[model samples]
Target chain A: MKNIFERNVSGMTERLSRSVIGIAGCGGIGSSAAVSLVRAGVGKLIIADHDRVEPSNLNRQYFFFGDIGEKKTAALRERLLQINPDCVIEAYDKKLEREDLASIFENADILIEAFDKAESKQWLIEEWASVFPERPVISGNGLAGYGDFASLRIRKTGNIYFCGDGKSSDASGLCSARVAVVANMQANLAIELIMNKTGDVK
Target chain B: MGKITVNGHEIDWNDNMTVRNVLDRMKYSFRMLVIKVNGTIVKREDWETFPVPEGADVKVIHLMSGG
Candidate 1:
């Protein structure tokens, strides 16, 4: 019998199945990116988050009503597993520190920064760049509010790919559509990096 | 008078115009910004002190939070 992802574009299934992605911060961006990657048949994922699902998250996060109160990493892991039972997933329900990041993400081929706080995002990029200088990190910023989709763009700086408008904030509010757009952009970049056979930074 | 490029647009610059001055002059009120001068990151604390050289390229990227 053909596998669930066998029909995927030539070489995509095999390539994605061999990749391992690490996601930090299982919020709107992290959960959405996780689901997209899982659906694309990625081989493995390592996710970490200290937050719990709340009613507020339902508006934009990829969580069900039943997942309320559950730790984000646990809830997202369950959802991802339901989508792809064969995919290996490692979930951590704790905030990751700088010293612990390298070992936790040791096996990951790529890292995705899905943090919601500016300080956290800055910390992740700096630490990731210092610890895993060669690995590409996909991050999102300014994905709040609505409309002005044209401002949302993918920016590359060094080994990091930032996907978002780089401007919107909580003052303008957050919506599901805009958040998902940025999250999916990050996922798409991750997939592209994984599929690049030459392994050169694109 | 000198000129510096900000996000690709050439803007008039005055002597001793720091990153903070440019943002104020341009009326960019965003609180969260990642400012860079000539490809080097200028931390938020240094924006008031980091002076932009003539013909330098300044990129002011705003960062927002949702996820």
Candidate 2:
């Protein structure tokens, strides 16, 4: 039988199939990143979020209309499993706290900080970096508003890879296109970091 | 005049010019921002008092939403 990932000619599928990626948050960025990772053949994922799907999320978040009112982690898990039934997914439908960090991210090779709140992002980066200094963390920041897609780019600071324009305001509002662009950037960077190992890609 | 680099642009700096002053002078009104001075992150509470010395490198990163 022809494998679904046979078209992954770069040999990344094989390597990705053995890696476990962790995502914190399940909104627009988290959901989009999760879907992309699963489709890219990543074998394992650990996702945590306390949010529930709402009608407003349908504009950008990766959830169906029927998924409204469902826990984001649970809904996303269902969608991801449909993408790759063989992929191992661990979904936690609760707010992730410092106490749960170790057990939740123990096996993940990389951590994706997909939070929306500024304070949450700061705490996640600080805690995750302090706890897992060696693990690469791909984070999204300043990805609100619309247009200016060219400004969105990847920036590496220490072990954290920030993907976005680094300028948009929280009050500027958000659109689906820009959110997905940043999320996909985070996903793509995660794959590159996973494959390259050194994370020295220029 | 002494100068400091902010977000890659060199701007004139004066003695005792704090992060808050710099943001005000630069017209950066974003509420959610990460200010780094000389490679050190300045906490939100210290924005008004954290001094940006001459020749220091500063990066003001704005944090936004969408997931």
DockQ, per model, reads 0.43, 0.39
Worst window of 10 by summed lDDT in candidate 2 chain A: A193-202
Residue pairs with backbone atoms closer than 3 Å in model 2 (clashes): none
Model 2 global lDDT (CA atoms, 0 to 1): 0.85
RMSD of each: 3.5, 3.8
What tens digits encode model 2's per-residue C-alpha lDDT throughout A1-202? 1276878758788788888999999998999999999989998999999989999999889999999899999899999998889999999888988778878888899999999887788667766766787788888988989999899999865676789987786588888999999999999999988888753322
Off by over 4 Å in 1: A197-202, B1-60
Candidate 2, TM-score vs. the true structure? 0.80
TM-score of 1: 0.81
TM-score winner: 1
Per-model CA lDDT versus the true structure: 0.85, 0.85
Model number with the top DockQ = 1
Q: Per-residue CA lDDT of candidate 1, range B1-67, in tens?
A: 7899998888998899899998987789977666768866676667899989999898876666767
